[model samples]
Target: MRTRGSLFRILGLCLLAGALVAGTLLPVVALAGVVTNEASETVESLSAELADEPPPLVTTITDRNGDPVATLYDQYRIPTAAEEISDAMKWALISVEDRRFYEHHGVDWKGTVRAALNNTSGGDTQGASTLTQQYVKNYLINVIYRNDKAGQQRAQETSITRKLAEARIAIQLETTMSKDEILVGYLNVVEFSRQVYGVGAAARSYFGTTPDKLTVAQGALLAGMANNPSIYDPWSHPERALERRDFVIDKMVENRKLSEEDAERVKDEPLGVLPDGPDKPAANCVGAGPENGFFCQYVEDYLLEHGMKKDDLYTGGYTIRTTMDPVANHAAKESAEQQVDKTEENVANTLSLVKPGKDRHEVVALAANRDYGPDAAAGQTEFALPSAISNVTGTGSSYKVFTAAAAMERGVAGIHDTVQSPSRHVSDVFVGGGEQCPTVARGTRAYCVTNASEGGSGSMTLQTALQTSPNTAFVILEEQAGMRAVLDMANRLGMRKTMASNAATGGAPDPDAESAEARQSQLEFFGPSENSPGKGSFTLGVSPTSGLELANVAATILSGGVWCPPTPIGEITDRDGKPRPLQEEQCEQAVPEGLANTLAVGMSKDDLPGGTAHAAAQGVGWNRPMIGKTGTTQHNGSAAFVGGTPQLAGAAMVFRPDRPYGGLVDGGPGNVRATDGDSGNMFGGKTPARTWFGAVSKILEGQEVLPLPAADPRYERVN
Candidate 1:
């Protein structure tokens, strides 16, 4: 109102003041808050990661007999990561994922800025995750910051919220951990799926190597996968995985982690992986002994029952200096495999034989043939061995040897003791009202006859009866020894208990619904028992004994009463390679050396002229001496050859093919044939003896075979 100039100046001043106010207030209200590089410091904290408990693993070991084997374990888990992580792998990881991993605190600022700008310009959401964020997400917790109200709600509501809580926690982690420790924790906590957790496990699963052995390229590939595991799975997405790997190579070069030339070459390298699924210890091969799988399993079970831990097998790095000779085990398994192969075409059944020894036992052979299934036919199940833990039952004839040995030990019988065969029977009957039958009778008087019962082996003495394996003769002698003497003798030989636990339990009826059980229930081979000592069948080898038990008994004879517990394992060491001390071991000497020598001498005499083991005797190379025994069961079920040299002793057995068919698995007439033709005349002397000879010949280093220290005080044989 005062004038035109004054009015204009006032208006200008007002506009200027308003502009100043807008500028000052706009900056204050539009402030995006502090952005001083929200990078993590070394003082970061973190939540405790969940520790993984792995699966339970089992291990096993065995004797040549394929008996209850031994076992080993480490936390019952095969820790893939613990075995795989190494320094080489660490370097490779850095080379691929974060070359400046050690130099940077928790973020690569330049990388983050460029990524954020690109996302903003493109109107899309992307990430600039550094190694620290990746580790935090995978191991510590997830990190999520967003702009929407719902997003804010989510940040405060879910595990992601908990994860944010963890960021606060992780920021404190740096205070408690070193850089290397954090990295290790990251590697250990990361998951590669398939129940495999940790870089160590991934190394083994993917590359068949430990972290230390990881190739530069391999490390890069593995590290790169942590960004997106499913999309980069090499096994499932080879092409995509390779492309991702090449991208890593390019990034590595961009960051100067690798020279350009090296990077280019690595990018072009074709991806390859091991054909086998993964690399690990073969549990099927325990103690890494010569025996096959079945025998190993047997030994494993026995050891476990005897106080050996299951974990000691794998991680224990046990130096199982076994009593078994590898060469012998191989031979026995091979021979048995061949025989069983030819005999069984429907199911797999193998035989494993062991020869007892003074220094180390010998494996005669492990035999399995395809009579079970396609797997068996393919040789996959031979060592996989069927769990025959319950299939124990045989005749009682084997008990006679024990009876004879016991009588000798008890001073109740001697080599000179003679009992007329075919005479009136006088054996003790365990059941009600015993019968009085005559000895195997000749025309008018009883005379000893061989087990064959074809003709009289002549009026042979008691020792001669043992040498000739005369069934009639032993029966008559047992009668004379009296029931108490025979029973007492059998008990001492360790045949007091039934082989099958079911038989030992109550004389219960068969609960097995399987047809095989129904059929087996009717046979003596099933080993049905009403009492400890049955009334009549004790004369014949009618008691079930494992190949191991048989070998032990024969070993007792060979060792002259010294029952050396068969040694299958010798040494165990810790992860640090320190040897583990074992508890003191003690063994019981079950018989006198004199009595044992008598059994050995009597058995060895079979290697002489006109003995039941004449075939075995012929194989001994007339230049040296040998001792052996042959037993053929009724119905052609089992044929056995138990024998040894001065330094070694062993036994072999072959199940005849004449077994009646039970089911599709019974391996009927058309099932398959044993390597040896299933001729009616087949005997243990043929296959078992030959296999035993093959194994022993290798261990003996061509040494002369000798008998036990002579039992004949009157007649001495040179040692």
Candidate 2:
């Protein structure tokens, strides 16, 4: 009475059932029958292709104290082992999805025959997939074909080939893995809702609990969602979800896994989910909050730049422990914001700190007054203002430290050696003929430089020049030390990014199509040729510079001339808890240790009387022995302060971020200009120095005070 199509469908199902049965018992001989041979081959081929690929999982990023900073993931999943799942959850899943899960060799032949007969007789569509078979199906769609639309479609299609493939893989899995293992794998791989995968993530998302802590009702609810997460989503369709949940409980009772009395009681309970629904992990760096977001982004970028694949960071389930000190970072953020309101339109304040060591220079904090987010109109930005070289501007006289180190290294001048601090000096060797250096002398143009204050007009010891930061004194010292030496020293002592090609100008210069700005950048930083005499303004810190680089320069001196890359990562581990090696730049002695020690001493008076930062230091009640320097740019466009104790080195910068050429002035809140101006007064000793002191004092509070290394006599006087 059946049609030919129906007869063929029934025949095929019967033959598959027979082959599955025979393969488990009679083995080779049973599958040799002509009708079952093709089915047998398909099963064999699919079993070989079945691989236990790990699912995409969440990657957690934490601070130095092991507190979570952020979490990243492709699919929000946290895989749990069989033992980590509660018995109630396991039983509920088995009861509703597959009652005979323990007894099945994988393909329940009787169920297959029943489904075949019913479908051929024009009844509703039915599936005979066992738990292992469902696991294989979900694995194929979510893992193997995750990125392939066509493959995922084929895996989910209601075709005989797909079902047979699932059956074969399921049978193979049963032969290899225990029932508990297969069941847990299914639970871990299945999707509970959009962007939520596995019971581990599901428990937290739905009920704000863990897998092992699920109650009977919670277990039944989660188990019901595996059938069709979208249709049974508790947040979207509460009534249907509750109905499905109760149905699952009833099934548990029928399967004898739960008592009828318990089922009735649980069915009357409300869907005890979090009022706000799913509590997903924080998304990327912004989730780290404004206080730590900048440091979080730096950590993310540092890892990616150092050979970690983007996919690996999102899905590798890595536990990245960074060097961000919560105390230091909080202090830095509060200090920066306190110095300059985050909503300030024209001016920006930023700070960076590094813990100095001969073997490691851990970046403790990187913070900006601007809130770290995407809402730029609200004065929030995700730009790497504290560390990126592109965000750097003229750091004023902070560059003098490099010139001083170069002079000492070349035996031209020592810390105690006398240098002339003329009010104005015209260079004989270096030429000047640009907007930056337009002062001409005689018929030919000469590079003329002047002191910032009238008091810097007489001869003084190199130590006095460091404290007062006289422009002409360090400029004259730069020439004596040779331009190349100073430039080299800057690069060696943590100005690596600044000395390289301008990242904002599109990397290395191209003579054919280079812009005027790019050409000027090259000339100012690198000069026309390595052999050419350097710019006279070099010692005056006329070039663009980074805050973090300035802090590391101080760190290098504090670490006895050992310059280690400012690293944010403290440790990294894989999902299995194996330590992963980080490719960090090695530390090297950038200058003689004795010279560095003596230079630290020479620079130590900046926070005392007669020094630029003395007022700021005294205002903060700072009495600790520390090395410090303050710098103000030529046009007062930017100001910076760098200082350090034996434990920490840090730098602060206040700049016109919107208009780099526009000058800053006092008389506004926090002693800063509300808007940019043509030319006005703002010094590193004011807002920048105070910001530095504010953060450093809080960071070093309660810690033992440590003394700096003694000044080396070799570099204390001219030899």
Candidate 3:
């Protein structure tokens, strides 16, 4: 109805309104473009940093039962393949995190717009970042945390600038990595709880199961926990965890990913988390239980000394199974602790058991009255050996067994060979150019040795002399047998060139002694170290040896001269679960089978009726065909018993009262009596022999008893 000029004015005003709206929107559109471009640049930089290189995996060690003994790791991650991730878990994450994930690129435009509108409209501040953006952000946080403080700060800061940058990077990342790759990256790096950084760890730490094994309820529960792990810890807040879990289930049901009936059913189910979750396994011998700690530590040391890469222990995912018989080990421990006198600080007694046959593998059962550690449970000054291989005691009369074998090998004597032993001998020890025996000062250049029983028995067979452990006969026997033959025989039976564990028997000089430097300055020949024991008294049990080494020697005789070097490792597997080649067994025939059998007969239970180790023949209850010998070094400072059956072989030793560190693991110094509770002297023929009997009896408890060869044919053929 108005005039034409009025109509023009109204049209102009409507046009102006349109112009104002366009002007208002232009800056916002342009601003979005600029922000997206900047975000893309930041994402590009971050993508280059995230190589998706997973952290080191944990190396688990298990026992014979596949029970976990130890777990070695810097980060406790048990990585699994993506295929193991449950579909239910994936859906739970998608429903909670990115509803429009499949349709959108990495940035999820629909989600971002909705979130922005809700935030501006006085609603909940929704972080509509897609899974891809979340993954990119987490990776950036990881990279920045390790190497760049500024990058970390920017990643953590809550600002529009940061959000835009993450979106651009997320979009670019979508073009590079597939959806699954981004999802896996997210699963591996997402922090589920304190000291626990991945969904794999979360499943194990919370549900005590693997990702593939997760049920719908458990999957949803774990995914729900990822929201606010600190405030809603399943372990710390069971009520909160239940509430969040139900919420996730509701979301899945609302999305029709899960049926309403199934959702309701799972909602009422308990969290079903293991009470303590995953048990953190101990990593080393220090925590491998008090009973097995020393043995574990010994295996660790033995591997390093025998050429295992030390660093591989921590980084390599190796599954190493050892040759330790827990039954035998426990038996030996019980015997050593019970038979030996605990009252004496220096009265150290230990028993070792070895089973080495072509059929049955060699296993070391090294057990002592006191644990292998510093300080004794009852005393301050005790014999504490740092390693199972450390030779803390002398070989003692056990060395004579080797001498007898040497004599038979050279055909100088037979089991029935006859000799008349004199109370005293004044003859030069025929060493040729080798070292001479250290003895008391006498008028003659030759060493004069007397018998413990003055006026040596008139006439006795070689077996009789051995059974009596008569020094004069053995010395005379050694003179006829030749020292070189004995030395070679000992070496073949697992004796190292350097037989000294310390300076007591002329080994590497005692550094604690003023004369240590001079001793270390001594010349070396067969041994790498000058600490080698003196040669003169080699047959008199002067050489130092460990119980494990002695066990090898006895096992040689038991295996009919086939000497197998003691080994702890049964098998080793690499990080990739491939079997790694271990050192081959170094077995050799040190003596003829006939000679070994003959010696076994001479030291057999029947033979012991007239032998020094006769008491060993009378075992507590076991009647297995056993052969053994008793040993006592000078002044009875150390005693030993080496014995074995066709199935088991080993040695037991006891140190003198004055022998420091020989009886005490770690204790204040004290003196042990020469005898035990019943006034029984700590003789190798007594306590050590008793310990051996008890130990081997337990080892052979239910095994079949075997018989020795009636007579070694080689002995009959001897002239």
Candidate 4:
């Protein structure tokens, strides 16, 4: 590796080098730390180990189409062969960095003497380090960082003792390795900028081209910047970079490497920096920027949960191909950033889309707007990630389908069953059915229930209840179906408690683990501290989940009840280029076809005025037959829409205003506006519904527009 201003860094090389060449160790023996005989033996030993080093490789990540999307690197560098580097670049570096590079053995005695005299004479101590010595110093530094940080600090010490050890090593390095090997090694370890190490990476970052393509003028500019990458930044300080470039060209003329005419001509040329865009993209998924950053994290989490090793991801040199559709991914990003106003704190949008099927379901898009990092939020560790995963507090009315389906699956109710309801519904059938479900309020036992105001008071059929998503209708249905039945249906469909660990949630899910009572509280015996939900509130979506899972649920219903848990990775290859085995396909028919179809029909009524997510169907503009549901929780804490066609399904959710119980957006937040200016606050039908609509519409643009399955005769409204 190369070091800028290295003479001061190598502590005491001059005295030892002079003494060794003079055939006497007495003058420098004490400062050198070893006797001449011992030093000679040590140098010989290091010579044999230099031949075993290997070139480092970088890992790649691509989309399902085999298009490169990002790279994961431990060193953020690419290794280049000595033969491939351009002569212009090679000469330019040699001309500016080490004039007597070819003439020197390990160290340049003449230049060394001249530097010592200059320092003794009180002139600024000039750099006398030959290219070989610098390579040794940089090598020592790199090796030390691998295991001993304290050694690195000592290696950088500007003391006589440190320099003697470096000189001794350079002596060994020069004997076993050829001059070209030393040059290549130095180029590979040089730090050109922050997290950017090596001439190869620097060339690509600044010029958008390989080292072999650099012109003489371009080569000089890059070489000049090596000493001070920050100060000579062409992007930020063009004038200073231009001045250094010209100075290097002038130095070449003085050294007679270039004729006066040639140097003058080169000096007048422009900096010729890479324009418009960067050749080197971000180092990994986090660097993919705000548009796809969230999904990149999703892909990472998926791979880790599967079989890929975490250590292998950043350094194992493997390639991973994921099933992310560019079209839908971009659509979701636009909907989050432009379509939705996410200016306030804790307000973010996450959208996930799935391809319909009974077997492996391809996840199309899992995108969010905000860029994420360790410090993404002011007081929270994460915001966008939680939203994409839908691991939040409540899902609201969007959860009505699970309760409705569970009742039908168990024969407690039919799509047309006229379940008795009321303007206000209480869930405490366990304690008292006639009064409001008692919940503690202001330190006293209180009874409570309220309708969405949109659902007028009455006994409602399953079809009407689903279309309107009324709190009362869902509560009545959940009570009739038995709490166990509703809880069983939700668990079977793959909803997990928000904070459960990944290992616990993944693999085959257990639908019956939580008895209906377990859904309300951690305790087996119901008590006041239970949160006492029972089955009635299950329809209200009290649990936390993710957009990808929810979208997969919509795809499940569209596929005639078959469910395929969302899978991100299509294939992965080891460093050896062989495909590695991944988890087996997880596919299940979680719901009965008849019940699933009945529920799908209610969502397919988007063409009707009361269909909660009608705008989503219209957004596609294809007139394709599709189905979905809208959800808005209490306090408007969260808004979500899960919509689907036979071929495509997606879910979008928005959390707003950042507080324990801040205002919510059912139709639309009064301040938030749509494409046409108007307050959006309803149910999941408004903003999030529109986002789900926009993404699915674009995702299914060219695919076949299949109609929903023919409804069963039993699906007609029941009295």
Candidate 5:
């Protein structure tokens, strides 16, 4: 074991070496002869390893109007410039931590010698780390070795070697960085408490104010915590923290940073910290609250999918401006909850809205009746109910609009072309109606379809067929347009995700499946297939779909055929305010303008008399010229409504979301059932239509009224 005299000799040699590197002259010149070449080389090597990279900072997300929505961070740090910090804070820190901070190069040799003698004499343990040395130590622990526990421990270990290395790095840093720069860097990197870093964040946390506005007492309390945060935490040990704060104030008085009268006056003041604790902003999308959380989630997903790394999002200090419209989102959320109670188990009502334009389709709102959170017992979930196709069921007859548009595009039929709408019809080419319909001679199971009402039993114009949403009429119309054409039209008109995978399986078919039957089953369920004409029910919307995509489909038609991705990001900038590039808008002409115009006109009568959604439209006193379609799946498993004016488009869906999902039956407010639908009580005209109208009316209240595009005579040809 080393003797006490030998330990003191070693400590003296380390202090002398640090003094020599820091350009300080000490009286102990004889001890310099004891420093070895290996010790000198170690200091040089460790100093060279110091990098000037920035520390992790909070990333802020804002709405279109630049209002803050949420903040994300690995460490709750907000880097502030030297001039932005108040003089009280700098004085408080300097007075308490190091009185000779400006006079010393990096190490205070006199203080080190004093501390060394006091420590060896068994007096109060004292630290002689200068402010610059403290900065070097914290930079190594919080930034360079942030992910390495052992490396952090080594940097913080109570050893002479670690102290020498820190001293050497601090000396080198003073040469390259200005005195104020070094001071600000130290202030920004040091931890004030758990997960809280930087004087900027500390000022806001402890005093509920900005760094430039901190008072003398508040600055003293925060600076005092830098020595031992856990012991001086105002939230946990108020009395001890007050004592520390008073000590700092006395130090300020002694150092001439403040008058004795001012010091005493400030010390007598109460610790004005937030009553609860640090005023940390909520972290991540969940902190965006229930109303805007769904839209926030979609923005996050869009950024990640476009190329942003998860780490970059949390620590890059980026300012992401999203296209969330507060008014529209609030209306949608309130309307959805009015239609369906948020706590109602497994029953969800979701809505999405998109602004229509040829150059950009900005998604402004995504709302669901269920609260966006992580508590299942409280009926809250983080699932992307309005945007994810896998979270929804079939959209029912809302898809007939796609088939009608396909017919108009292919020249197979026109808006005014007469089509046979029988009570029942059997599809000979497509397969699988199991036992309900017999197979034809083509050696394929027949697909049988029937109208939802007895009134759909005569030849009617294609426009009338859409208004009534006759299942058999659209199924026959799909055969005329060719199933492939209808499926392609749906894909081009914003059903990309739905057409890209099998919704029943929630993803693409598994290529490594053990049996061919399993693969075939996955391929044929609710999506396009390779070896077959697309499902005959494609026109009837008997496939799981996303509300955002469905709303975009309306937006596509409103834009006169140009299809643009529903983008949520408005702009992005780096920490220094330089604009950053995002994924370019991908807009394409999916169909001829004339064809889209005529189709929009064909769908215009849906909210008028004799249409499926007429009652819901009348209830809202809606008089704007618009296009709309209503759909309800077989057995009432789900109901949907898609509607739009020239300015905006929206879609709403009501469905059962539990496993082995079943039908939703309407029986007045609380009497609704999710498991049984044999009575066929629910329809798209009820909750789904009401939700769409209620939200859209509020969103479009002040906007200029625009009529639907005029129909092209060519597409209105008589059959």
Candidate 6:
């Protein structure tokens, strides 16, 4: 209903003044297809015939494929002069709004006199301004020329002097325009609510229909809501709205606008409203756990990082074309949710999947706590950690996937490179002690061991260490690769973005600074380095990272080391129906396909029984194999499963946020349990695996999954 921005800008003279002024013209003279009439003349003539104009209103919602999901509006419009306006609406508006609508051309002298009398009486505030005057105030005045909050406030405030000025403007408008023209302007320019401006919005918001199609009772209701809408809004206050509507119907019957039967029928009709508006997520994932909430939060954060406004997420009326398929997303969520129940440990899980050369991705599943709330899941207080979707854990053993890729990409080491896994010492180790930590490999001088911790696998290749996820194996590799090399590789693979602690503001940070000795102690590494002292435990997957973080860690390998900015929105169109093109982000290749293949081949070891991901391999066919890893922190409290099909990459996480520090000191290790309830065996293979499988299967039901491009050129059997 509001005029286009360009048109408003072009005619800014009358609007420049503090008062709102609008001019209307009728067809008084016709020459060469140009109809001309004096604005004053149309306003001054009450008997002149007017052309019909039915305002257009559209409601549309589309799917990811740009197909119409739903539509609620007029399919076609056939205008006619005899198309009578609702008499009840006219009289209700005229009675309390403009009693002199049919009299005085546009300006009502008698009404103005009465308004002045009422003002002087000083009993209650009253306005004698006509509808034409009100339309001018809503559009021209509010749309332009106002500056500063005070100016805006003043314009909004209706007063006696303003009413008088409005009368003069209304008279001018009526003199130059036909009655129908004035009516059209009035219908178009009126403000129904904050965003519900004009009759079109009012129709949808209230009766859920277009203006022309409104029934007599519905028309009366809309007319009643014209002034002080909030008090009579049917959705918010149905009783009051119905009372006001009945008042309009009564007035129409009194004015002979409608017969007694029509009035009775319409007044008794039940009010119904159409549902079409933005639905905000309750907390994060719609009464779901933290894993989903966190992922949604991650998407929000990504948008913010890309310079999008927070308001846009809720009210921008934008359709986001995400790389996520709803089916896959639902499947993943179901799988993860179902899996979380199997684990007695207090934990959460999240998974994401992406396909090759496609914009559609899937967030398979996420479950934050063992149960939802206190006395809700299992009467456990440990479930109280904030379940917001952004609380991603630190990448534990999954970090090696990156480290190995970094070595391969930089040529620091090859998949065939020899490393002693059983050796006692290596580099950049963060935990464990001297003699007890056996040196499986010989490289730098910090004691390290396999993840199993029994003894080293003797001597093994770098690929073997990766497949086995040995603690000492990765330490020796990291030592040889150097911290700078490892960090460089991490940076290339989007690891910097995964560091939740490094956020600018509103992020969690260490409360107290560490002592000088503690800082020095933290800097020690297992690899031989001039900058870092040797301490080896880097390969055990002892680090921390969120499901998304680890998912992307695997995603880098899945994507052939080419990083693409994940997005939910595809294209944005303006009100004028013009598409705004978004720049396609260029891909950044972080590692060679050959190296990625080596890791993929090793990761495929999960299909074998001795492999960490043996559970995931149990029921799947050989047509499209699942390649991924299963990680468990020292305590059984946290577990993760990261894997993907040829088309998608996703990660699922499960952890106990409330477990006391290590929890081992307590007889039961507090929230960090190794098994669920009485099962005595709880691992990622159970719940996390089920969630991962369910989601993956549902998502890939009918879709084709391309084979992952080989990462190692030297490995002939990789394909």
Worst 10 residues of 2 by lDDT: 1-10
The superposed Cα distance between candidate 4 and the true structure at residue 412, in angstroms, equals 3.1
* lDDT tens per residue, model 1, 31-63: 133321121111121111122211222333334
What TM-score would every model get versus the actual structure?
0.65, 0.86, 0.65, 0.72, 0.86, 0.71
Q: What is the C-alpha lDDT of each candidate?
A: 0.48, 0.80, 0.62, 0.63, 0.80, 0.50
Question: Tens-digit lDDT track for model 2 on 594-704?
Answer: 998999999999999999999888887998999999998866778899999989999999887766677777553365664445676778898889899998988888889
Off by over 4 Å in 5: 1-52, 109-127, 145-151, 158-161, 237-243, 246-270, 375-379, 440-444, 505-534, 667-680
RMSD of each: 16.3, 7.4, 14.1, 8.4, 7.2, 9.4
What tens-digit string does per-residue lDDT give for candidate 3 at 1-719? 12222322322232233222322222236346655455545544544454423344455555544555556554555555568788888888878877677877777665666765676577877788888778766655542243478878878555455666566556555655567766766776566655565677778777777888888888887788777777767778889988988889888987779999999899889988878544444445544554555566666766666777665564455677777778877888778767655545556676777785743336557677656434455532223231243344465667777777888888877878776677655445532121243433343234445565312466666666666766667766677776666766777765642343443543455556665533442122212233322233555575556777777787877777777767666777766567877664567777788887788787774224555555654657546677777776655566778888878888887764343223222111122344322222345666777788877887787788888656586763354
Better of 1 and 2 by lDDT: 2
TM-score of 4: 0.72
Q: 463, model 4: CA deviation in Å?
A: 4.4
> Which of the two, 4 or 6, has more TM-score?
4
Mind giving the per-residue lDDT tens digits that candidate 4 earns over 245-288? 88888777767778889888888888887775335766667565
Q: lDDT tens digits, residues 1-719, model 5?
A: 11312322332343334434643422336325333233355565554544434577778888899998888787899777777899999999999998888888877766765665566577876789999888777877777677779878877765444555566656655665566766777788888876899998898887888999988999899889999889999999999999999999999999999999988899889999988889897768888888888998898888888888887788777889999999899999999988888988778889999999999999999999888878777778798889887435578899999889888887878989898888989986676676788876466678898888623777899999888888888888888888778878888988887776654554555677676644443225533467565578777777678889999999999999999999999999876677878875589998888888899999998899989999999999999999999988877878899999999998999888775257787764345557753345678888889999999999899889987899999899735
